[model samples]
Target chain A: MTESQFPQCRVVPLRMLKPETSERYLNEVVKVEGIRRMMVNGPSIPAVVPYGPARGSPNPNSNRRTIKVGDATMELRVQVGSITFEVEDAGVIEEIRKVTNAFFTQFPAQVLEGKFMKTEASLVDYCRYGPNADPSVIGLVDPRRKEAPVIIQGRK
Target chain B: MAYTPQYGPGTSIVAENRRKQMNPNYKLEKVRDVTDEDVVLILGHRAPGSAYPTAHPPLAEQQEPDCPIRKIVKPTEGAKAGDRVRYIQFADSMFNAPSQPYQRTYMEMYRFRGIDPGTLSGRQIVECRERDLEQYAKMLIETEVFDPALVSCRGATVHGHSLRLAEDGMMFDMLQRCVLKDGVVKYVKDQIGEPLDREVSVGKPMDDAWVKAHSTIFHSLAGVAFRDDKEYVEYIQRIHALRTKYGFMPKEE
Candidate 1:
């Protein structure tokens, strides 16, 4: 496997964001063109009480609700701590930085440029997708998850 | 000469706060007023007004054991009433939370009686007779030790202690047990992730300045840095050295 050709940048706010805030931020970022793929990461909020005495009980978290980003609607599994994006080039990263700077007026957020995504597919990814796996999709989402990544359509 | 016990060693404000918490003689400042019923509700051990269930018969009715220890030591109210063992656990955020797991254990041990405190990296659990536990829980919540946003009562699934705070300055709870509404933090669910009948408001979260001033945890980014306290570092190094040398029976030169 070769290194990813696209440049990656991550938006790290001082605090984890609520669903509404994350949705607003995602909508703002998605407006910036040249972004190829994006990933939201944070502590997992399961559908059920995953463990303890209340295991299997319904976990009704306000933060885990479905959010509409651009034209795509997707359920948030985690309290979004940070967002990483693979962009077309450095120009796109600068555009993202501007969006982040303008958007996070209430709280400070940093747009860091570096290798934030898995460049090569891991052993688990190889086993899950087999030999002819899409490089863009690999390591994008959890291999165990049955659902595919949601693609936010461009501005109409 | 009389020997005075020092709860901990340090010069930093965080250390002073820690010592203040551990010193039983020092009265903990009442920061907020969380009612007993609210505490009982948050504990989720029993209903707010229900009677405390017992694990054994009342001590007064039971046959007395002919032991000297029993003769001298009086049973606590809960023990005498034969109440069942119950627990209250707390997860404190790393970002200038007033209290942390080990600090909680130390404070509880120094101040409370008949408690079995289990301390972990992120959370602290204290088990005691149900009646006694309610009282302890009340103190733990109402005192300066707890912050509405930075500290949370989480019986299980306590995973947010070390994570970053939410944009609203609240810790991340997977169960979403509590919510910040109208600037007040309210518990919609009990400690163990069970939904409550009604929202129990703790209070508005303390501002950053107040939280930092009262925080017992040493956080480099938010509050006092641990390395800044030279005496604490030296004490820790000495203890570490002693423990390492114990196998070889090392003596001080």
Candidate 2:
């Protein structure tokens, strides 16, 4: 198995971000160049009560809503816990670190360098995206989810 | 000399808080005031003013069994009235919420009667007769055991205990049973995720300092570290060693 040449890092804040905070943070981070692909991950706030007696009832959560990032408008299904992204090079990580540092003044955040993104597509990915699917789209969205990944046309 | 019970073993503030909660003699400081009607609304078991739906006839109206054990153990009001069994569950945040699952179970067993507590990694559920459950639920919500932000009442989908708190410091509830508005936390939906007819205000979230001090869970980053408490570690180690040795029946040295 071969690994992707691009480096990945995750920016974890001490507190999970509200939708407004997440949008602001994303907008700021996208301003920096060399961020290839990004994903916002956290505990999901379902559109409807998923289980128990109230299953199928509408789940009205303030945290779950649509937010605009650069030229893209996407719905946020989860409370933003951490933002993970694949960058073009190691230098981009430093630029992101500076951006995160300046952004998270109210609370501390860490820019952890590791292999956070899937280097290779799994069986689930194959089933969801098919054999000739774009490598960039792999592992971006949950396989169970029918929703596709959002493309943010950033300034850079 | 008369017997006395030591609730738990620890030197840290978390341990002391745990002991305080588990000791019936140690009165929990009342932090909020949630009315009995509010609790019923949040519980979603029955209407606020409706009579308790019974599972059986009242004990007084039923024939008495000639048993010594039955004679000795007096029935609680709910039991005597034959109220249906109902439950209330709580999910506690790992970030210095006042209590944890096991701690809740232990504390409930010590302080309340006729309760069946189910303890999990992140959530605790207590089941009792509907009438008794309302009284107990009211006490749990209005006392120091509850924090409007870190602690939430969730009957199902209790998935946010170990996750990071939201930017506003409220625990993540998938159902969003409660919402923080204008410095106050209000329950817009019942514990089971059904929308409430009217919002039930449980008061504002406690400050970080108060939560840290009153918290029973030992968190390394947020609150007191478990390793910092030597006595607690020693006690746990001893128990671990004894439990392991007991299986083998080793002779005492």
Off by over 4 Å in 2: A1-3, A123-130, A143-145, A154-156, B251-253
Worst 10 residues of 1 chain B by lDDT: B242-251
Specify the poorest-scoring 10-residue window by lDDT in model 2 chain A. A136-145
Candidate 1 per-residue lDDT over residues B1-253, each given as its tens digit? 8988899999999999999999999999998999999999999989888988999999999998799999988888999999999999999999999999999999999999999999999999999999999999999999999999999999999999889899889999999999999999999999999889999999999998999999998878887889999999999999999888897987689
**What class would a CAPRI assessor give candidate 2's docking?**
high
Computed on alpha carbons, the lDDT of every model, listed in order, comes to 0.92, 0.91
DockQ of each: 0.89, 0.89
Model 1 stretches astray by more than 4 angstroms: A1-3, A132-134, B251-253
